[model samples]
Target: MELSEISKSEIEQEIQQSFEGLVEASKALDATRYFEFIDAERFVGLNADGTNWNSIVGLRELVEPGFNAVEKVESLIFTNVRISVIDLNTAILVNEYEQKILLKGGTHYKEAGGGTQVWSKASGKWLLVSISASSKP
Candidate 1:
């Protein structure tokens, strides 16, 4: 079904659900599950590290070290989130995030960032296609 066929409210709700899934997987540090929300074949985005990523393999290579080293998620919060439905099959979401994590060896890591993501419906499901994000320690 094309997103254009759905009401804007419905589209927004679908996007919300997808984002919630992403947040859950991220908080659990589940790389495999977390990536399900993305369109791996088409994904091209700016990483938190300020590098452009066009390959999921490269993204995994860069993020797995930190992902694997996390002992626990102390907190992960997205604030001031806003969603916009652009067109049939397209939407955008922007938000600011703060996270505190417990890494291996009991060290804590904190980060703050803002993110803009472009999502499109694929096979009737919303998949993240691109992201532009900024990060700071």
Candidate 2:
């Protein structure tokens, strides 16, 4: 698709939908589905607001433990999102969100946070290139 044909609103909506899909995959403990949206070879993740970024191998390793730790996703909301398209193939997305999760062994918690993600379109598919998220209790 041409950059002139795409609107900022459209990219924003796509990112929002993809983020929700990630949450759903997490809630279901479906690693395969979760990885579908990720660009594993070029992935970079800053999970839980951590300073050090995780590479593809680290990201993969976290899938089982991360989802296994979450029994259910009680609530997941993303808001105040902004999308800036650098080109037809690249965009930067920023957003704030809050989530309530039920963890394994009956632990429950609520977290609020914001994130910045760099998305790239390759072969007509939008793939997550890098992301950094910070959350508070």
Candidate 3:
């Protein structure tokens, strides 16, 4: 589809929903659902751990440990979201996030950061093509 076929608001709404799905899945540590929002075949991203990954397997290995260590999600929220539509097939979203979790060892983990996600609709659906996260706030 062409850019003229879709309004910017529509694209923003789609990306917003996609981001929500990812956050919900992450909060619950549902890897399967979390991966659904990512474009596994052509994914590329810089994780919060400072590791850059070009494949889904790399992502799973780099991030799963923390997910597994979470005993409960105390809070997960995103604020100041900004979305830029590049075309009908692509959009970029940036946001600030705050997350607090209870670990299996009975310690609380808290983090606040700004992140970016590049979303693509090339495969007939919106999926994260790339991601980047900065250090805690």
Each candidate structure's count of clashing pairs: 0, 0, 0
Candidate with more favorable, higher TM-score: 1 or 2? 1
Q: Provide the lowest-lDDT 10-residue window in model 1.
A: 1-10
The full ranking of all candidates by TM-score, starting with the best, is 3, 1, 2
For each candidate, give its TM-score against the true structure: 0.90, 0.82, 0.91
Best by lDDT: 3
Kindly list the per-residue Cα lDDT of model 2 for residues 19-88, writing each as its tens digit: 7787688667798898887887778878764754567777777667777788888987876777788776
lDDT of 1 by residue, 12-121 (tens): 99999999999999899999898899888888888877789887776677667868999999999997789899876889999999999999999998989999999999
Estimate the lDDT of model 2: 0.78
Per-residue lDDT of model 3, residues 1-137, tens digit only: 54654588899999999999998899888888999999999898898878888788888886688688889999988867899999988999999988889999899988899989999999999999998988774
Q: Give the C-alpha lDDT of model 3.
A: 0.88
Please state the error at residue 1 of candidate 2 in Å.
Answer: 14
TM-score-best of 1 and 3: 3
- In the predicted model 1, the residue pairs found to clash are none
